[model samples]
Target: MALLHRAELRPSKLELLAGWLPGRQWFAGEAGAPVSRVAAYRFDDPAGEVGVETLLVRAGDGPVLQVPLTYRGAPLAGADEHLVGVIEHSVLGRRWAYDACGDPVYPPLLAAAVLADAGQAEEYFEVDGKREARPASMTLTGSRTGRPVPTGPVSAGPGDDGVTVVRVGDVELAVVRRPVPADVPAAGGLAGTWPGQDEPVLLAYAR
Candidate 1:
């Protein structure tokens, strides 16, 4: 039988978010509400330097806002145990665990994800929320170095009122443009199969 290297769930940053999301003014949940998880997915970087996680959370009475996060294992000065699990990656064969979005290698790792999918090239990065900051538009950026080569012209997808869609190669990521409520069921576990090498949706972002 094939070995199943599943993610060991514990009190993660999700615990912090459980209390924080309901307090935000931009939150779409009801006044004084609750939120929880619905499903999630994990992706391994082709280069084996980082890991990407997308969480599909169903906030109370609101639309599901997809939260994308990156993980790294290099010990950060202040991260310590807050970095979640430090298990050996089945694919990478190295033990790693840390909030990767803030890792110095995040930009290139993310850019690699984009380029590997035959999507856009080096655009830019962003920082927001309390956890791993997010990457905003592709046209804006101050960092200019090519770890992941850009392939072609960037394209847009059908975006909703608060969602932003960007086409990377053949994939479409729907990024959340606005914040929403935080009252909902907790994510029981991550869902969906591993993303193929080239799928139409690299990630569907939310806020």
Candidate 2:
């Protein structure tokens, strides 16, 4: 389960994304337009050390962008290239955020989710030392692959058709960087939905 805290974050998530998104090669938004977060989902780290989350956001009427982020108490060794910048959390103090694609802890968990046909992790909020169930703003569904989950560092590279390829071992997983029409199928991979959406949107597939 993923536990959320009702606390303030210095610079905030959106603030950080606003400054960082435009510099990304895949961002389709107007450089100066404001960005709005549509929805978000979380995945729990089995070890409970890393916080994983994916955010769906848009600038104007441009395509919805999928950004997976990982939060850690300290800098992840060898992940300087993926750093989104450090920020201070009101409840957790300082945090280091990185693009999930480059985080060593992310790919294996994501592959496991796909192979197990799992959804996003359940969420809870702490209040008065008690945890309360919190509904997720977004939902994810993975397709069973039956293959053993791949391990090792993931190397991300640009793929054909605008997808991002995350290589684990010798297997390459293609991640849809932008939201596509609902009629499109994700095949044997992953799909997601946000509130008010009638159909699951394709997110990624094994390649």
Candidate 3:
């Protein structure tokens, strides 16, 4: 289960992405465009430390961009280049945001989603002493190919033509930036349907 808090952020997630999105090699959006959150979903960190969430945002009229993020209590060492930014969370205090592709904790979970059919974590919001289950904003489904989930730390290469290749041991995954049917490498990968979009779109591919 994913536990969330109703808290304020000094620089909200969208604010952090507004500055970081332009620099991506795959970004094809116009300058000074409106960046708004479309929807989001979370994955639980088994260790219960990191906040793993995938954000879908639109910049102007461009295609929805898939921006997976990891929020941490401290800076992720050696990931300075992929660091999105630091923000002060009203409840969690200081939080470091990193591009999920560059974070070590992301690959295994992504592999599970692609090969093992793992779904996004169920969410619950806690306010005061009360806890209430919250529905997910989106529904994600795995390819369910039943292959062994990739292991080992991932080292991501630079984004090229809107896809980032993440290497985990012997498995290589193509993480799509702009989720589209054409980005699906072969047929097995993680696919999802969000609020506005009922048709499934490719999110990542394992090859």
Candidate 4:
């Protein structure tokens, strides 16, 4: 389960993305366009530490873009290249946000989610000091193949065609930065559906 507080972020997520998105090679939107949040989903960290969230955003008239991020209380060692920005959460205090692709906790979880039948985590928000269920803005389901997946640290590979491949041991997990339908069936991967997109689209795969 993922707990969300009814708190404010000093420099909102969009504020951070505004400056960061333009630097991404996969971003096709016009520079300096206003960014809007479309939807998002989350995956829980079993140890209940880092926050893993994937946001779908749009800029101007550009297509929706996918960005996965990890939030931690402290900076991740040796992840300077992947740091998106620092955020001040009203309730959580200071947070270090990093690109999920470079977060060690993310790869193994991604690999397991794609290979197993794992689903998005349940979300709840604080309202009047009470926790209430907050349904996810987007829904994601993993392809269930019952196949074994790699565990432990996974090194992120260079992006190619809007996809980033990460490897752990001999296994590689491909994550799609731009959501699109796959030409063929997914052997083991993750797919998602949002408000405007009724059909599930391929978002990742184990290759």
Q: Tens-digit lDDT track for model 1 on 64-160?
A: 5555555564555654533544445544344445433333333333344333332322212223422332232221111222334433444443366
Worst 10 residues of 1 by lDDT: 182-191
* Candidate 1: segments with Cα more than 4 A from true spot: 1-8, 12-14, 23-26, 30-34, 46-49, 74-101, 112-207
- Candidate 3 lDDT trough over 10 residues, lowest sum: 180-189
TM-score of 2: 0.92
Better of 1 and 3 by TM-score: 3
How high is each candidate's TM-score?
Answer: 0.40, 0.92, 0.94, 0.94
Instruction: State the C-alpha lDDT per candidate.
Output: 0.40, 0.81, 0.84, 0.85
RMSD of 3: 1.6
Q: Could you give candidate 2's per-residue lDDT for residues 1-207 as a string of tens digits?
A: 999999899888888888888888888887767788988888889899999998898866678998889999999998898999888999999999998988877777767666667668889999999999998887787877677777776788677776777878766777777866544334357788877775888777776
In Å, residue 89's CA in model 1 sits off its true spot by 13
Better of 2 and 3 by TM-score: 3
Off by over 4 Å in 2: 182-187
Q: How big is the positional error of residue 175 in model 4, measured in Å on the Cα after superposition?
A: 1.1
User: For model 4, what is the error of residue 115's alpha carbon versus the real structure, in angstroms, after optimal superposition?
Assistant: 0.9
Q: What local lDDT score does residue 124 receive in model 1, on the 0 to 100 scale?
A: 22
